[model samples]
Target: MRFLSGREAVLKHIFETDDEAPLTPVAVTVTVTREGRTTAATSGTAIRNGDVYTFAAGSLPLGVYTVRWDGGTAAVDTSWFEVVGGHLFTVAEVRAYDADLSADRFPTSAVVRLRDYIAGEFESITGRSFVTRCRRIPVELDGSCSPLPLVDVQATTFEDSAGQTVYAVSVEPVGPFTLAEGEGSYTAELTYGFRSVPDDVKRAALLRIRTLLFAERSGIPDRATSFQPAEGGTYTLATPGVRGSETGIPDVDAVLGRYGFDVLDDLAGVLL
Candidate 1:
């Protein structure tokens, strides 16, 4: 007797003696195959006459697969599934060994902790208070639910970076913002108390941001455009990803000093 359960695929098999006779505890081996690709095999103990065998989900991923069993008796049963995750990041949605975020493993329990850490770091770097409402929207395409659950994470704050305080009074996103399906962007209103940002500084920071946001990202265009806000508000960019926003930290300082507040810096604080 055998038991099997899964989503994408299912398997059926049994372990018994010849002629339904009671068999001594026999060693059973089960091999699973998917799309002609042989996955690993598992071993089990024989289910004596009228006995039951259970191999709960410690093995196998979500997908179509075939299960073959041989209890030293004969090649008896097979099964398959469409569960999810091909293996690691495919179904998991979140992965620990992300080179970009440099996260260890995708841990669900620490979302807020991660966000808080970013907020704290932002305050430390900019010397400003961040009053924000953080929301994580799970991203999904093809109807496959995200393991990460929340895909679109948004954190809005009035915190001023060392640059925004001087170069710009404020900036805000125009009302009626929109996001196209399968895309991401953020918008904000901006105000500049200064005459205008120096072209050299603006170009330098914009270059850094563009490089940071889209460097590893794919599917979007190789280039992007960023506009300086006339007033103090949100600096927004719609990219291939689900969102794009700004710390309103002027890039002017980036030219004067190290470009710490560029996209790389912001992501380091936020990617957590």
Candidate 2:
């Protein structure tokens, strides 16, 4: 429920010739572009600190920025990072899952990193995440109505393709409603995902981490297969039933079914 911004970046200059060597070259140009327009331009000396180059030119704006470095000894390379929130689960939560597995606790330094990896895996499997963060999300409202994947909407404005603000007004609750027709485009700044992690989602995450720990101990690949019957007849009704897993892991899928499954998103529409 907290909003955050004003992140800084520090760029490092490492020589390819020697991995440990630091070289400060001439004519360094750092250009920062956000959304599309160039917001900050600075020379090398302003950001240089011995071998390291920091974006101390100014505080980076809240949105995504494209940082470009050039005229250095290395090739013209570009990289990016977002000023985002912390992970969904704390080290304690991750360690609790570890305790459930009877595995030794990971080092404190590695706990956050491990939690991040596990959270990524959970999102990959469930098609959703537990933590909410602010983002400029592009919304397509073409009259096909569905629940917006937002916990809360901060601001929304309709706009045309030419980047001009359209004059139609929208009122909350902003989602799970159909947009009126003939409105070409719109964008919403929303705080998406859950404010607090759901209990079922946490259970699924713990089970998944347990599966991984068991696999690590046993030295087998962390993969499993499961099956479910096709609709229209019970498996015991003397009818041939299809076999497959909704998400390959039964416990995880059972929890996700209540929170994350989207039948329409996975459905293949009929074709002529």
Candidate 3:
């Protein structure tokens, strides 16, 4: 399940015994963790409502959080939830992209789902996340120190293999820089990714969603690789078959190509 940031995160759990009977424990407690760090561990009992135990986790920051419930009688359970800022595109933006789209015909929920689906597809193609979040990445020191495999990194901190804070490390905007002293492996806590989706990326998503909506409404195949016209010309789509990166739409692919690995490598001057 997912919740928006700064919203009350009410977690619920139901405990059952071997015979599928609702078993109310003597005491219940909740613990929350994010990015391997414990943010909240409550000793207070969770509110019980019949067989369901609910814990008010309060407003949490943006990230995937893990919740553990200890029922004190070995009735422990774990669950996870994510808190996000918002979707990549808004329904209004979608409607603005295509003036023909009307809420009465398309519906807001459907547009939201399509936007989310396209955002996921965009990430899958680029192997890059657009949401701003903290990530712990393992880095190896090899004297020459290659750039980290990320972009738009905001800030970073380093810790050695033993998890002790390492002060001898430096960084370039997107990756870990040369270490002044130690070698081997280290963990870099990077606060990276774009705070807002780029305009080009949003356009790409909008274009893909338009194609999907068209196919769904008109009953035409989504992606047509090849089509022959009666006028006698055989046309082939310029879909890059490398790991399913291309979307088979020329305009969408054009926008994505600007952010592809090849372009990133060209800008960084280092093959990644």
Candidate 4:
């Protein structure tokens, strides 16, 4: 997408007035796809640009990706851009993600989350049948320092206001996040997604989730944590009473229905 200078913001620690902030995302992850299949995507850091919220591409897959940030208002702009192998990303098309929607109906993370939580609660509460595509992908860190290289969907790709590159990782998928719920009768496409990453990139994303579970801090941001380094193709997260490695990441069932959808929230919990 051809993002106007004011249409998006660089993925960095944006300093803005609280009331001026778009929305505080507890956790977010990058999700993308190409050629009707999944790609190697990545994400990093949270950022905001005035009223415009933009997420730059990270060290994700090589191909054309329709990128957009998905944590703020549905009124937030989403544009389409193309990624090449030996060149920087190019914008092919530019338009608002939800420009046509009524101002009153623009979707936000909270609005989406509340709807999903209610649907799930409704199903569980009254057995009305809840439809969702949430699943956990276990992970293993390998072939890197105890610390994983950074990967991201757009954070790294977007140059900061200072015009310096952020070393976070990135991801590009074969497609976008999906939803098949009958109530809404609508699905979200993978225009583009964003995520925060550490310095280690060799670690497969699945293992990244396990790192969040067994390590310290939180996974929503996927911030770095203290862990014991292991030999060859693996990293470890351990403590006095507990220790673990990428070899055996566990999968926890869907505990909450965020946004009546699973793609972003599920992965968000796993990565953060």
User: Which model scores highest in TM-score?
Assistant: 3
Each candidate: what lDDT? 0.34, 0.50, 0.69, 0.30
**Count of clashes in candidate 3:** 0
Instruction: Report the poorest 10 consecutive residues by lDDT, candidate 3.
Output: 173-182
Residue pairs with clashing backbones, model 3 = none
The order of the candidates by TM-score, greatest first, is 3, 2, 1, 4
Candidate 2 whole-model C-alpha lDDT, 0 to 1: 0.50
Candidate 1 segments whose C-alpha is farther than 4 A from its true place: 1-25, 39-49, 57-59, 85-272
Worst 10 residues of 4 by lDDT: 86-95
> How do the candidates rank by lDDT, highest first?
3, 2, 1, 4
Clashes of each: 46, 0, 0, 56
| Cα lDDT tens digits for candidate 4, 199-256 | 1211222232324323443432233334334554544433222342222232211121
Q: lDDT tens string, model 2, 30-139?
A: 66665533445433432565655554435443445566777456546565544334455555676666565333544644544455566666565555656654455555
Model 1, range 1-272, lDDT digits (tens) per residue?
A: 11112332223334555699654335555565543234464334333334443343344432345555555553455655333221111112223223333234324334323433433343344332222222212222232211122112122212222212122122222211112222222221111111233344335433433344335574434454444556866444444323322332345233434412344444344434
Model 4 spans > 4 angstroms off: 1-30, 72-78, 85-272
Please give the TM-score that candidate 4 achieves against the real structure: 0.21
TM-score against truth, every candidate? 0.22, 0.55, 0.64, 0.21
Candidate 3 lDDT for residue 102 = 76
Error of 3 at 137 (Å): 1.9
